[model samples]
Target: MARPDIVELPLAGAFHYRPHPHHDHRGSFSRLTCDETLRDAGMNTTWVQTNLSRTKARGTVRGMHYQKPPFDEIKLLTCLSGCVYDVLVDLRPDSPTFGQWTGIELDGAAADTLYIPSGLAHGFQTLSDDVTLHYSHSAAFSPDHQAGLSYRDPQVAIRWPLPITALSDRDAELPNLKILEEAL
Candidate 1:
């Protein structure tokens, strides 16, 4: 096993992966996100909501989504059921990671979690038949404040695990990364 490496990236969030202590075939245990843990990593947002999504197939892509403006939220995400190749793009103009992207492979067997700041775009593609994603948000959901970026945007250059096979009509129409930045 590899030692847990703390990754400090160019953004307004902090993240660290703690190895899960497995005792038997039953499973392992670890906290995905804790107030004190986040605080120590430079994230001070008090999670106000917990959301989960269950995807049925490898190609089930469901994001590049975020809340705009006053409803924008910081998110802490983890994969709890299967595995996924998660991607995040910095959309905050003032951020050092602006226009940059980072990707990680998250799975139930690992104690990996992703911390995404309020102004980044997030999405993932499942690597298994069933994927359950858990997330903590710093704000409430508001349909009117919802926004998204094109998962296929060439500028962002995210390498998805599979060709996008399923997406909502709304998600399909989101502007490309470049256009979204211009519109913002």
Candidate 2:
């Protein structure tokens, strides 16, 4: 048999993905983060905060959020238990992908991950009854610097899998992308 070569694909500006290998029984494992892999992808940022969250129901939705300038953070997110429809929107005015959005389906079984660069708003909808998501943020959480766009905004129509059964009051009240652009 011949060995398989590893490759990275650019999903969007500053966002990349590489297939990971998984071994049996002890559950699966993947090197979702590696200095060499990151270096090759040309993403030169350090992560400082790692967070994990588990959802109890299928219709859970979170975010469409990011921090403001000077505190804008870059992130890497992975689904650890079930699955989710991950969404990202470019908020960088000067970025070529500005105002554009991308979506990816990630599942624990698939071991897929998503890389979100700074100046993007991110959110996800649970695709399974119970799901756990993990993320690493380059900056510490700052409530004062936190900002977001409405997940249901028509300007960037994101087709979530289900109606959000629950959302934080803050997340539900975020302005739309158009409002965000006007604020800039």
Candidate 3:
């Protein structure tokens, strides 16, 4: 199998990976993930669940979501169709870069994946219609442990590339950073 090229992001434990895709007359084939490569990078996370999300409109925002300890998850996200501006925020209070955020553009054409470690918030905005995202998670979903920060919270202050055109009622009702900090 071909090895993936992993690029570390500014935030600790976050990575952008591009698999080595082989091109032939019919099409191309690539290994999306490799245990050896992940082990080499010290990111051998055991994924227990896989999820797929499809967004039909541009400027649609989803998440800034994470779960509390014991249920907090590590995610590997990839764009399956169309494009998106993926974002992540460091939520580990004890870490040096806590609350800082970074964004990356992912598209189906490039077939790159973003790896997000535990203790971080993950979200994204669709840049094109009919965008699809695939996720591999280390932990199972737990409603009781689920928590989120408002995507528009001033404290987190994410500058989404495009105007937010859509958001769920639950996401719109998420608490701000101050409240989250107090709870933490």
Candidate 4:
């Protein structure tokens, strides 16, 4: 596999990596994650869980979710099919970029991955039908530790590239940013 190109995003502890895929007559091969590359960037995470989500409709939104302390998680996200406008919001009160957000278009053709550190909220909107997202997490699932901020919270005010078409009942019920702030 060729060396992965890692770029730090504006938010501290957040990174974007593009793995070099080797093309052949049949197809191509690429290493999705490299410990050496992560080590060089000061990130050393042991992924314990992997998840796959398929969004069937364009404009489908999912997220603004995170795990609380003791179960906080670092997530490595990649789009396996179609495309999405991935979004992340810094939730660490002490962080210089707290409350700030960043969005990127992840295309299956590019095979780019986004590494989201703990203490951040994550979500995405599908730009095309049948989008698939793959995620690797440093921590296992714990429903009791899960929390979220409303994706449409005025305080976060994310400008989704497409009009939202669908949302899970749970995501639709998430507390607003003001409520999250009070709890924080």
lDDT of every predicted structure (CA atoms): 0.77, 0.78, 0.89, 0.90
CA error at residue 2 for candidate 4, angstroms: 2.7
TM-score, cand. 2: 0.87
RMSD of 1: 2.8
Better of 1 and 2 by lDDT: 2
Residue 99 Cα positional deviation in candidate 4, in Å, after optimal superposition: 0.9
lDDT tens digits by residue: candidate 3, 23-134: 9999988788878788899895689999999999999999989999899899999888899999998889898888788999998777879999999888999999999889
Deviating ranges (above 4 Å) for candidate 4: none
TM-score of each: 0.87, 0.87, 0.96, 0.97
Model 2 misplaced regions, further than 4 Å: 1-11, 14-19, 24-27
Please write out the lDDT profile of model 1 over residues 62-122, one tens digit for every residue: 7788889899998888777898888788888887778777777887777577777788888
After best superposition, candidate 1 residue 43: deviation in angstroms?
1.6
User: What count of clashes does model 1 give?
Assistant: 0
**Local lDDT at 78 for model 4:** 85
Residue 151 displacement (Å), model 3: 0.7
How far residue 10's Cα lies from its native spot in candidate 3, in Å, is: 1.1
Query: What C-alpha lDDT, on a 0 to 100 scale, does residue 138 get in candidate 2?
Result: 89
Q: C-alpha displacement of 34 in model 2, angstroms? A: 1.0
> Ten residues in a row with the worst lDDT in model 3?
36-45
Q: How many backbone clashes does candidate 3 have?
A: 0
